[model samples]
Target: MTDAPLGRSAAFKVLTTGYVGSTGPGVAATVSYLTDAGRHLIFDPGMVASPEAILAPLAALGLGPEDVTDVVLSHHHPDNTMNVGLFPRALVHDHKVEYRGDQWKNRDAEGYELTPSLRLIRTPGHSPEDITLLAGTPTGVVAFAGDLWWHSAGPADDPVAPDRDQLRASRERVLAAATLIVPGHGAPFTPDATTPR
Candidate 1:
């Protein structure tokens, strides 16, 4: 899982930064855009105020839904997969399957490489089906970790996690593997001493 920084390689952009209100009002999933090996990918096209919140940014990047070759769901949670159908032409990926045009293909997500620079790995914690998308970009390894971390400010532990121990271990693996992490509901962050394990 080590990669030297390349002069030109995969790249990623935050399409919409999400938020979790302290009082349970404001919320959305952080949608992301990634480009690797001529593939346009969307990560977690989930709950948002509107589809435009996600689409406008992609449009700004000169991409339409049809241009999205793939969409990766970090988990089956509504917040992480609600708007998956927006990308009509994309092959949707879950932890254990790939869906496209009414056909479901079974596959293992653990270490599944979508491209030389984009890979998927199971990191169940926030949910048993949770997975993470790791992108080897020119900058460094960027992990689109779902609620394995809700945000940079670790709740220390996920309050709703079925198994806190598994959550902790998953966090450790993500921390060890990614130099930058795009959490489920926050801006991208560089893990530091303050980051929870």
Candidate 2:
């Protein structure tokens, strides 16, 4: 519910508490920057609520789907990429080799730039399409680790199995570079907070 600027990025955290008449569940979306070029980047459009419900808050941040120049999807899951259609003009970015049979036609995951302050990391964990975002902040390099690492009660309980060993490797890849970790559904913390050092 707090719309505050984190560093040079216009970041907003919209908390949707679960209850009757509520907006599903808690979630947060980060808008990477307010550019002089009239462009902005959004990361992970979650499923905590319908895109319509968050329109007002998004507008308050001087953003609407039309104004968004790029959308970085951490994965193909509904919670992350479902609202993609809302941003018809914005280029969608993801690591999914093939996302939902052409829903990702114009999707570009080949190192698309997300503001001058951030870059995308292809991290396939929770799913083959999963990826983590790396951004430079005042604190340091913070990785928006979609479902790669949960920050709640414990580490990711359901890590991708050996069949998807690539995912586990991907986690290692990000952890190696990640200084701070911002998960998809929990509080943000340092990578060491979850890694056994």
Candidate 3:
């Protein structure tokens, strides 16, 4: 993979696309953006796509991987981090705790600044290495909350629920910091987004 410069200011755009899966119509992947000193930085690149899958949408935006300076993964799950190698020149970011031995030598989680407008928070629970990207965008402080809390399930279903105290703390952190939330596998939620029934 090649490393690119992270944008100094942050900006974001969402790309909604289909992912073939068993969960009925699968959820859309939320791709966040940051303007690194005028360049573009993409948060997570979902499952690998064929050349055709990448062309149309990207062309619509007039962007290609070369235009993407970095990719910050929220965790190591294949669904979230599978396309890390595709951007042959973009640097990959993730949390240190999520490193699975040597499988990810090029990934970094030490928390690099994506842009003056963005910050990365390590919010482990659903997975020990899960991290959320926090940014102050024009809308509000938006949290790219990767699987830390899923809109589809209540906190009770979180894999870390057995540790109620930790889960509660994690939830509180998200609620307190997020005025807007972008969850890993569901619709974007307003400040009132909460665990569903």
Evaluation by lDDT, superior candidate among 1 and 2: 1
lDDT of 3 by residue, 1-197 (tens): 11111322456665543233435445435555555356566666665345334434555788876776667788777666656565666756788532232545544443545565666766676777777777666656677777665553543466533455655666667677666677765556775544531
Clashing pairs in 1: none
| Clashing residue pairs in candidate 3 (N, C-alpha, C atoms within 3 angstroms) | 2-88, 2-89, 7-35, 7-36, 7-37, 8-36, 8-37, 94-109
lDDT of 2 at 53: 53
Question: Candidate 1, residues 96-122: lDDT per residue as tens digits?
Answer: 999999899999999888887888888
Judged by TM-score relative to the true structure, which candidate is superior, 1 or 3? 1
Model 2: CA > 4 A from native: 1-38, 96-112, 152-154, 159-165
Span of ten consecutive residues with least summed lDDT in model 1: 1-10
Ranking by TM-score: 1, 3, 2
TM-score between model 1 and native:
0.95
Best by TM-score: 1
* Candidate 3 off by > 4 Å: 1-9, 17-28, 48-55, 97-112, 152-156, 160-164
Please estimate how well model 1 matches the true structure, expressed as its whole-model Cα lDDT: 0.89
Best by lDDT: 1
Candidate 3 — number of clashing residue pairs?
A: 8
